[model samples]
Target: MSKGRILIRNGHVIDTEPQPVAHAHTDVLIEGGKITAVGRNLRSKGAMVIDATDRIVLPGFVDTHRHVWHSALRSAAIDIDLGAYFRLLGQVGPKFRPQDVRIATLAGALECLDAGITTQLDFAHIAYSPELANAAVDALKEAGLRAVFAYGTPVNVTAGGKLADVRRIRERLADDNALVTMAYAPLGPLSTPMETVARDWRIADELDLPLTIHLASSPNNEQPIFALREAGLLREKTLYVHANGIGDDELKLIADSGATASATPGDEAGRLRRAGITTGTGIDTVAFAPGDMFSTMRAAHLAGQIAEDPQLTAKDVLRMATLDGAAAMGLADRTGSLRPGKQADVILLRLDDLNMLTAERDPIGAVVTEAQPHNVDTVLVAGKVVKAGGRLVHADLRRTARALRATAAAISGR
Candidate 1:
């Protein structure tokens, strides 16, 4: 049998444990993709040693909600309101062919990996054809990253065209279980018909796969929830993307159904800023952010405290972004904590960074309030070093960025 071991030495391990931070200087042992031990002075004879001195080791980030196809269009929709955003999705999203989707998805996934995100739930809604879906999935696999390709159906342009041959794709991916999982992403109520939504839910239920849908964005739009109820498809297996506009009845339904919510508080705050609205409307869903997990956690914490109770702590925010996100993606049992026997999806943050240093009194608060992507010094996924010393190790990012730019230009007719 093939054997390998990696020893990460002298790092401050922060595994989302409830106790008051122990083992300031310690080592972690990884053997065959799982963490075997975490403590001081680990036996490392014949194992590859990684110096982790002066670093803070924690579980790798799990991005619960992200549109990887929009990587090339980062901040491109900043000026557009919600309606214009939808217009762009309707008009320009379908213009992307399979190649475009491949380049964008690969680039986006690589970006997340380089920035310490180990698991990403990519809401790929640009499935104009089966070829497009296949290409998107291929891109994720090629990146050698852990990901969930939330395969979304095409919009109304193609009447009765299925997104992709789900059976064929499943068969192709069934054996290769290293880092990819597929899920159904039925475009929320606004873009997809209710009957079609029910059909998608049925397919997911039959396959025992998770279902993801966007809901509760605008306070004026209750149609998504209403449509789900009408179709009798709202259940525990469903993952509601956003609950920004969900009412008390909707929250109760979500809580009772045992379904999960993945909220992007930073994006919601950005949207609210752009539209000149209050940020409190979308506070109920599971909060998350792609580029900046700290901002998301802080925003969610403040929102929760302001709207509900003022005594909420920083741990609550951390749990929402870390553990809650993992649960929402059905990956809590495997990740979301620094437990032995689990995949070593982990990261090390440099606490000496300026933003992280000031709030030293509360390390969790410091991470939630001050730390940013730059503070992440190392990232590991499944016992492999993907990023170290703040740089990517697996793929050439400059090439990917150039390719993505060219593809975006072609699709946008620029």
Candidate 2:
């Protein structure tokens, strides 16, 4: 794999370092690990040149919510809904050991990279031990993906034990600029005690790490927004996931605090708009929401349309999939978009492909509305070609898939 300097020439670039900057045809230079330049006809020696003639170059996707360690149970919970998910996870979650977590996290992270997602928040709600947490971090490091290993505290772990393990893991993976980093996946006030939640939130804040929690899903884990508000814990660094069915008051609370929301968006536009939230999109479960950020984007767009909100656009929806997502993961200053001095995490989408040939009139529209993972022809993480020519360059997917399959079989007694 070419892991050094790369110069991609002659691609239509969608550079959203913040606002969108579209270049009809330009050059982007990458040296070491950062984007050196983005312009027309740039020249640099010793850089491996990539001819992106028929490609659309954009910043790689940021997926804010994915239970990546559940890859071992891919088809295990697809048909189930919100209620069954909690019950099933309660039953099957304990079955996974450290080896299974490593395999699942590595394989799942590679799949996201292959799908043009350069950064992810792996909601690893399976960390039952310090060894398991370490294995999870090791898997992300080995996969060479930028990630937030959200430490999902096991039910059996005391609050003190949770903090201790998180401290150990964070110190071990102490590089704030490392490709793999740590985040707190607190159970929140709904599942965890209020005092414990406060303590955990304080720990995350003091560590300068991001915090992500399952948001106020109704009929079970409801009213979490108020609980968090009462404690004065809602802030910009916190990412509330699957923020469905939240009330207008809760929306005001979230929006006013400078916090952000992540939506899976099966049907969530009304609440999101009411909250006046700059909502980011995410793929939640391997059993359901795989590495399909495009689908989530489309769902968000449709939700806005369905709610009759006139402020939505396909391009802004695309922003949710990229820039806003980086904000949700608390990494906007690093890996979200194509800019000088930011990490070179980018993707080359094949606009010459069948589905895009006729629909390529509007690049952002085509990408948001029609393009799927199949159109992702190349992916780069930190200037390295992790996936090229529509395939992952650094992983043995078959071996990993086989191991997951075997693990699933044994767990099911099949």
- The C-alpha local distance difference test score for the whole of candidate 2 amounts to 0.80
lDDT of each: 0.69, 0.80
Per-residue CA lDDT of model 1 for 285-387, tens digit only, reads 1111245566566776676556522333566556555565677787877776777887878888887777666444556666666788898888888888878
Error of 2 at 352 (Å): 1.7
lDDT of 1: 0.69
> Looking at candidate 1, what is the lDDT of residue 149?
81
lDDT of 2 by residue, 1-414 (tens): 867889999988888756765677788899888898999989958889999888899999998888888777787777778678777777777787788788888888888888888999888878778888887888999998889888886544454466787888878877878888888887776577778888988898888878888776454447878878788878887788876667778888888887777777656644664567766777887676555788877877777776655555787778878887887677888887887988999999998899889654678887888888999999999999988888888888899889878777766773
- Give candidate 1 misplaced runs (Cα > 4 Å): 1-3, 17-23, 155-160, 175-177, 188-193, 217-231, 266-290, 310-312, 358-361
Question: What's each prediction's TM-score?
Answer: 0.86, 0.94
Q: Model 2 off-target regions past 4 Å?
A: 155-161, 217-222, 269-276
lDDT at 115, model 2: 80
Judging by lDDT against the true structure, name the best candidate: 2
Q: In terms of TM-score, how similar is model 2 to the real structure?
A: 0.94
